[model samples]
Target: MDTTQTAVKLILDRWEASMHNYDVLLQSLSDDQLQKEASPGKNRGVYLLGHLIAVHDSMFPLLNFGEKQYPELTKIFIESPDKAVAELPSVQELRTIWSKQRTSLKEKVDQLKAEDWFGRHTAVSEEDFAKEPHRNKLNIILTRTTHLAYHTGQMIYLK
Candidate 1:
């Protein structure tokens, strides 16, 4: 494999491992535990879970795989503050959504070719993206990896 191919494989492999770890951690949480905040005046585990799902759902359109399935998630988790909402999806509900979303996303990512990983992502014009080839689908995976790790740390407080 070439350097770019090797790098893409490494990123995807590591991302898959991280996501697996996150799934394990999330599944271990109790409903009571998920309600507790990591810190005072901060988001709870349930909010964090929903927010992560919302972000992942957005990746569909952002990466040109498909339209977002959960646009309402943006209103609840992205646009609104953690505690601003009177109601959010329960842990069980979020778990069901997350499971389906993750499975679909993994299938899409697995379908990508090495060249597809390097293709222009959403919003970047073909001309501009050709000039800045590093701004591609793999970059989105890298960014989301960091996001997953950050939220994983907060969820750790639930344990």
Candidate 2:
């Protein structure tokens, strides 16, 4: 309708497209294939999947949606590199978590008004937000959309 609404729609559309592309790519791979490295000595498909989930889970707190659903994943998937942790969640387990997390996140995101996207996220101080208005909740979506696309490109090598 308005310029702000159009802009928000564009950003969200890109995020959803990136997510859809990732889902299709991941679904095409089998468990055995996911376990293999995306490239020699690089992260595996499963590792990338977990890493994405961990990053997205953090958005809950950053966006003031709530506490992270899987804070433990931050240690295994974000703090440590692939294979750094002796034990990792099964591929199926990660898939289930990913689905649930995305579903809940979508519900919350859908409830937001267009103006809400321009509000300061929890991570930014009010003083700073006043000075730097671009650092808003919608910016997180833009950044994470590109982040997802980046990993999705890497995972393509696993196919």
Candidate 3:
């Protein structure tokens, strides 16, 4: 495989690992624990997973044409949505969504040309990102991939 293809694959591989980790952690939690908040006001694992999906969904607009842009990762940080972390759909439901979304995202990453990797993307450096044109798409993928890891670690503790 060429460099670009390899780079894109690496990102997808790492993200797939992150998703596996999410599954394991969520599985360990008792159904009640699944809903337990990380803190007094924090979200639970179910909420966090939903928030994860929401976070990535936010990127769709930027990835598309930057129409429905938001300030940051979540509405997860905003008032909790009706779907509690515990109250999300069944594991099978989540599994299907997760599988589809990740595959689709990976396919998109694979399609980018070398130049397109840095194509005006503000994913990593949107606000906290340094003021430069260094917004590589791979970097953005890694950034969000790592974010999922961070939350996965937090979810482990909740159980």
Candidate 4:
């Protein structure tokens, strides 16, 4: 394949591996431990998990695949700080959503053509995208992979 195709493939491969590691880390947690803070003032495992889910949910809309699967997640996980909101979704509920959303997102990503990975995402205007093509769907995957890795580290503190 061409350079773009090769690069996109590598990105997807890394993304899949990163997600697998995240899943293993999450599966290791107990429900009781999920409620504890990662650090004194930091977010809990449940909150971080929800936040990651919400961010991934946004990928559908952001990458032009479809609307977000969990808009409500934005309010509790993205918009509000941990414990700042009176209540958040139950850990079981978020885990269900996370599993479903990950499968859906993987299917969507798998369906993309090599060229599609370099196409501008939903956030960019046509004119701007034409000028700044580097900000593409693959960029989001790379950024969000780093994000998941960061939170995965925090999750260890909760254990």
* lDDT tens per residue, model 2, 1-159: 999999999999899889889889888989898999988999999999999999999999988999999999999999999999999999999988988998898888888889999999999999999999999999999999999999999999987
Clash tally for model 2: 0
CA RMSD, predictions in order: 1.1, 0.7, 5.3, 0.9
Q: Estimate each model's TM-score.
A: 0.95, 0.98, 0.63, 0.97
What ranges in model 2 sit over 4 Å off?
none
Per-residue lDDT of model 3, residues 1-159, tens digit only: 888767667776787788678767766777677668776676666667666766766556656534332333254333456353234465455545556665666566556666576555654555544576556555666788899998888777686
lDDT tens digits by residue: candidate 4, 58-143? 99999988999999889988989888898888999988999999999999999999998988899999899889988889999999
- Winner of 1 and 2 under lDDT: 2
RMSD of 4: 0.9
> 2 or 4: which has the higher lDDT?
2
* Candidate 1 Cα outliers beyond 4 Å, as residue runs: none
**TM-score leaderboard ranking:** 2, 4, 1, 3
Query: Using alpha carbons, what is the TM-score of model 4?
Result: 0.97
Best by TM-score: 2
Model 2 deviation from native, Cα RMSD in Å? 0.7
